[model samples]
Target: MTPPAESCPALVLNADFRPLSYFPLSLWPWQEAVKAVFLDRVNIVAEYDRHVRSPSFEMALPSVISLKEFVPASRRPAFTRFNVFLRDKFTCQYCAVRFPTHELTFDHVIPRAHGGRTTWTNVVTACSACNLRKGSKNLRECGMELKKTTRQPTTIELQLNGRAFPPNFLHESWRDFLYWDSELDPW
Candidate 1:
C-alpha cells in the first residue's frame, strides 16, 4: 500500500526568529492562518481536492493549520543560508549598504587562507565595490570597520536556503521574524 498522507503541521516564524504562526504543511492561499492553534486541539478547516477518509487517532484533520504554541525561547533556531548573498540581504555587511542581488559577492571576514571556515559567521554579502576594495585583506588592514557584528545564521535563515523570500510566507506572526532580521532557522 502507498504511505498515507500526513496531517502534520509546520511551525512558522517571524523575521526576528520569533515564533509567529503555524500552518498545516498543506495549507495555502485560500485563508488566513490563526495563532494559538496547534495539534488535535486545532480544527481542520479544509482539505486537498481529492476525496479521502479522515485517519483515526490523527492529531488534526488539517487541510491547513497554524500552531498555538510560541517556540520556546530555549530553542536555538538553526540558520539556513546556502548563498552568502541572501544571507546578507544583498547588502555589504561591512558597509551595511543595500545593493541589487546581482551586485553582491561573497566575503570572508576571516580570509580562508588565514583560517576562516566556510560557515555563516565567517562570511557575508558584500557589494562589488566593497569586495574589491577589501579584497583578501582584513578589515584592520583596510582601515574599515564592519557596521554590524557578524554572527551565525538564525533559525529563519536556515529555512530560506538562498531562495527568494516566498510570497506566501509573510502571514500572521511570521511578520515579526521576516522583516529587518538577518537570521533565520533552517526549515
Candidate 2:
C-alpha cells in the first residue's frame, strides 16, 4: 500500500544537483513539488511507485527534485540559539560534554550583568549545571574554562558542522546527495 501524501516529501536540490541546504535537509511537500514540476521550475530526478491523480491526469510523486536555477548559499549565518548550539557541535563549553538541544543552554562569556551583549562572540553553549554554577560570575571567578573560544561562525563552517549531525529520518535516495563527500573507509 502507498504511504500517506505527507510521508512522501521530495528532496529538493539546487540546479547543480546538490541539496539547497543540508542542516534542514531541503525538502518540499508533494503538492509543491508537483506545482514546481508543472511550472517547469524543477526537474524530477526520482519518483515513488505511488501516484497522484487529478480529474484529467495522473503522475508519480516525485521523491527527488532539482531546481532549474541555482540558489547561492548565504555568506553570514544567523546568530540564533540553535545555530550557536550547532556551531559548538552541541557540546558544553564548560564541561566539554555534548548534550541534546533541550538540555543545553547558552552562556555569556562575560555576564550580561557585567555589560556583556548577546552577540556571537559573547555567547557559548553550556549545560544546566554549568549555567547555574557560573551564574552571574565572571569566568575567572567561577574558575570555569571554555572548551573552545566563542566567535561567529561563517555559513560554510556551520554547514560543515551540521554535516556531523544528520536528521532523524532520511529517505534512501537522499543518502547519496547528503554524504557524497564523506570518507569511504572508517579506519
- Score each candidate by Cα lDDT: 0.51, 0.90
Off by over 4 Å in 2: 180-187
Q: TM-score per candidate, in order?
A: 0.45, 0.93
- Per residue, candidate 1 scores C-alpha lDDT tens digits across 1-187 of 4224442233333323333422112233322332223323333333333233446522322234334343443234433333455556567887888886667777888888788877767878777888788888888999877777777655455445433444444334333333334467899
Give the true-structure RMSD of model 1: 9.9
| Highest TM-score model number | 2
lDDT, candidate 2, 1-187, per-residue tens:
8798889999999999888877867889999999999999999998988899989999999999999998988899989999999999999999999999999999999999999999999999999999999999999999998888888999888888888888888877777778844568777
Off by over 4 Å in 1: 1-64, 67-90, 156-187
